[model samples]
Target chain A: MLEAPAVAALTILILALFVGVEVISKVPPLLHTPLMSGSNAISGITVVGAILAAGSEHDAVAQWLGFAAVVFATVNVVGGFLVTNRMLAMFKKNPKSDA
Target chain B: MSSTDLIQFSYLVAAVLFILGLRNLSSPKTAALGNQMAAVGMLIAIVATLMVQGVVDYTLIVAGIVVGGLIGGVTALRIKMTDMPQMVALLNGFGGAASVLVAGAEVSSRITAGDVPTGIIPGAIVASVLIGGVTLTGSLIAFAKLQELMRGAPIQYPAQQYINALLALGTVAACFFLGMAPLDPQLFGLLVGLALLLGILLVIPIGGADMPVVIALLNSYSGLAACATGFVLDNSALVISGSLVGASGLILTKIMCDAMNRSLANVLFGAFGAVDASAAAGGEGVDQGTATAYTPIDAAVIFSNARSVIVVPGYGMAVAQAQHAVRELTDTLADNGIEVNFAIHPVAGRMPGHMNVLLAEADVPYERLVEMDEINPQFPETDVALVLGANDVVNPAAREDESSPIYGMPVLEVDRAQHVFVIKRSMNPGFAGIQNPLFFKDNTMMIFGDAKKVVIELNDAVKNY
Candidate 1:
C-alpha cells in the first residue's frame, strides 16, 4: 500500500505534468531552442537530492556516489541556464515592427 | 517557523518561479528575464538544501559545486552557438547521470546501514537507475554523432533489430532482479551496465536527420530520471520540476516528429537515414538534368529588379558559419527597397528552432524570422528565394515524387517563387540522399560556392547595383 506522503508526491507529479503541458503549449517556433534549454536547466532539480545524499553521514562508497552526483547536477544547472541566457541575449526586436 | 518549514516554503517558491519562468519564455522579449528567474529559483533551492537538518559536510558540498560550476560555466561561455546541440546533449546527460548516482548512493547508504530497501524505495531505485543510465549514454552518442566524432548516418548491422531486442529484454530482466534484491550491488551493477548498452543500441540506429527527435526524447528521459530520484528521496520539488521538464521535452519531440511527418515510434525505430545505402544504390546516377549555374552579379540583377525575397537556410548555414553574411545580405536587400524574410522549417538544422537562433545570433531582428506556415503563403507572391546550403527541406520532390524517401514530409515551397537562387558547395544530394528536382527547374539558378562567400558576393553585387 502507498503511504500518505508517497500518494501526495504522485498527485503532485501528475498535476505538474499537465501544468507543464499547459504552460508551455504556446511557445513559438522561434523560441523552441531556448524553451528546451531553459526547461532543461530546471530538470537539474536533482541537485537537491544530490546535496542531501552528499552532505549526510553515509558510508564511504555512498558518500563518493553522492559527491559525483552533486558535481554532475550542478553542471546541468549552471551550464543549462548560462547557455539559455546566451541564446536569448541575441534576440533583438525588429525595428520595423515598431511601426 | 522551523527550518524544515522554511525549506519547504523555499521549494514551493522555486516551483512557482519555474512555472512562471517557462510561461514567460515563449516570447522573445521576456525570455532573458525568464531565464534569470529560473536561475534564481535554482539558487534558492540549492541554498535551502544546504541548510537542511542532516546536511553537515559543507566542505564536500562546496568543493563539488566549485568543480562542476567551473567546467559547466566555462563551456557555456566559450562554446560557439553553432555547437549548441552538442552542448545541450552533453549537459542533459550530466543531469541523468547525477540522478543515477544519487539513486546509487541512496541504495548504498540503506545497505550500509544494514537494512534492505523495501516497498516503494526499491521500485523508485529501479526507475531512476534504469532511465538515468539510458539517458547518460544515449546523450553521449548524440553528442558524438552531432560533433562528427562518429558516423552521422544510421550505423546498422546485420540482425541489428534482433540483437537490440535481446538487449532490451536482458535489461528488463536485470531490472526485475535488482528490484527483487535491492541490496544486491552486483545485480545493480549489471542493471547499470545493461542500461548503458541499451542506450547506445537505441541511439545508433537513428540517423543524423532525426537528431531533433532524439535529443528531445533524451531530454525527456533525464527529467523522468530526476522524478524517479525524487521518489527515492521522498522530495516533492524534484518530482514537480522533473515532471515539467519531462512534459516539455515530450512536447518538443512530438512537434519535431510531426514536422517530419513521422510518428514517434517511427522516429525512434525507423532508422531514418540509411543514407549511405540509398546513396550507393542511386545517389550518383540520378540524372535530374543539368542545373543552370549563375554568378552573384546575375543574382544581384534579379534581386535589384525584384521586390521581395525569402531566405531558406538549413544545416549548411551553420556549417558555413554564414548567418552573419546572410544578415548582411538581408540589410543590402532592405536598402535596395527589397523585402527579405527568412522561412524557417521546424526540423531545419540539428535542432528545433535552430535557424532562428543562428539568425538571431547575427543580430537579425526576430520579426524577420518567419515560421514555415506563415511564410509558405507569401512565397507564391515573393520575387526571389535564395536557398543557402539547404537541401531536403526545400526539395520539390517531397511534394512531387511519391517514390522519394522524404516524400509527404512538409517542405518549404520555394519552387513556387517567381525566381529561385540556390547556393550549394556541390551537386551531391541532401542528408536523405534524395535528388532535388527544384535545382533543375526552369525558374531556378544554382550558385556554386561556399554559402558565406557567395552571400558576401551577393551583398557586394547588390551594393554596386
Candidate 2:
C-alpha cells in the first residue's frame, strides 16, 4: 500500500510480529521471568537507530542528542542482558525428578 | 557486495538470531542459550550500524556506551532478586527514553539544516516521541510503586476518566497538527509535555497489585516506540526486532490479565484499589468461623505424619525474605519421606512468576515448582498444605463467591488438601483487599507470625521430630 522502500520494511515488521506472538505464547510459566526480561532486552534494538543518529554528520547540537540517546540505549542493552543472565543462571532442574 | 548490502545482510541474520533466541527461551533447558543468542544479535546490529556511511565520530559514542555500560552492569549485578520487577521497569524506561532522544535529535537537526521532514517521516517522528514519552514516564511510575517510593494504592478522584479522555484527545489532535505543519517548536514542546503527563496519569490510577499488567503494557509501548523510530529512519532491523518485542509484551500483558480474570481496559482503568470500606474500618476482615492458632510444634506434627505436603507461597513470603527458610522445610519434609512440592499460582507475587524467581534464588528445583493447573488435582490427594504469607490465592471465594470482586480469578486450591496451615501476620485481607474464607475453613489452622521466623520454627520442629 506504500512506496517500494517502505513496503519491504513494513512487510518485515508484520512477519516479525507474527513470529513473536507464535514463539512467545509457547513459553511456560517456569520461565515467565526470563521470557519477559529477555524480550524486554531485545526491544533495546533501538540502539541501532540511536547509534545512527549519534554518528550522523549533523551539527554539534544534533550529535549531543545522539550522545544522550546512546547512553540510554546502552543502559537498556547492557542491564537487560546481564539481568536476564543472572535470572537464567538460577533456574535449576532436579536430575532425579521426572517433572 | 557493497558495504550497504553488507549491513542489510547482517541485519537480516541478526533478525533470524533474535527469532531463534526467543524460540529457545520456551524451555528451561535452553533458556540461557536463548539469552546469549539475543545478546549476540544485539551486538551484530550495533556493529553493522557503526559501518554506515555517515558514522565517522567515535569519541562521543564510545564515551556514552562506557558510562552507560558501567551504570547498567553494576545495577543489574547488585540488585537483589526480589527487586527484579523494579529493575526491569527502570531498564524499560531507559529504552523508551533512548528512542525519544534519538528521534528528537534527528528531527531537530534536520530542522536546523532547513530541511523539514515531509511525507510519512513527520508522522513517524510524532509516533516515536509520543509512544516513547509515555513509555518513559509510565515505566518510572511503575518502578516507583514497585520500589515503594510511591504509595501502592490507586490514587483516583472525581472525573478521572473524563480528564484522561480529554488529555488523550488533545494529544492526538496535537500529533495530527504536527504531522501537517512540522515547524511549530512550541506545539512540539506542548506535545512532549502532554505525552509525559499522560504517562503518569495513566499509571497513577492503577494500584500496585496490577503493576505487573501496567509494566507489561509499558514494555509493549517501549517496543512500539522503537518501531516508530525505525520507521522514522527506515531501518528494517529496528522495526523487525522492535515489533517482535511489542508482540511479546502484549502477549504477556494478556496472559497476566487473564490470570487475574480482568480485561486489558479494566486493568488500565478499573482502579481495583477501593477496598471494602467496612472491612477497612473494622481493622480486620470478618473472621466468620474460628481460626484456631497453631504453634510451630503443631505444624511439625502434621508434617511428620503426612505423606505429601504442598507449599503455597505469596507476596508475603517475598516481603519476609522467607524463601530460603521455606526451602529448609522442603528439605526436612523430603528427608522424612514426605512428597514435597510447591504450588505456584500464575499471579501469586507482585509480578507473574515472581514467586518462582525468589524460590529459584533459594535453590528450589525447577521440577518441584508446579503451576496451578497441574497441581490443583494433586491438592485433593495431598495430606497437608503449608501456606506461607499467601491469602487470596487459596480463597474459595474466587470460585464460590459470585459477588466478590476477585470472583473467577484462578487461585491455588490449597483448601482442597486434607489439612491446611496458613502462616500470616494477622487476619487482614490480601493485597486484592478481599476476605479469604479459606482461612476460616474447618480443616484450616492459622499460624500467625513473621513468615521467615515461622518457617524457621517449623523447619526446626520438623528436623527434631
**TM-scores, each model vs. reference:** 0.97, 0.96
Q: Clash pairs of candidate 2?
A: none
Isolated chain A TM-score, each model: 0.89, 0.86
- CA deviation > 4 Å runs, candidate 1: A92-99, B276-287
Model 2, B132-216: lDDT tens digits are 9999999999999989999888888899999999999999999998888665677777888888999999999888888778878
lDDT of 1 at B37: 92
- Worst-scoring 10-residue span by lDDT in model 2 chain B: B279-288
- Candidate 1, residue A11: Cα displacement in angstroms equals 0.4
Q: Quote the RMSD, in angstroms, for model 1.
A: 1.7
CAPRI-wise, candidate 2 is medium
List ranges where model 2 is wrong by over 4 Å: A92-99, B278-287
Query: Model 1: per-residue lDDT, tens digit, B340-431?
Result: 88899999999888898899898888888888888999999999999999898998888888877778999899999999999999988777
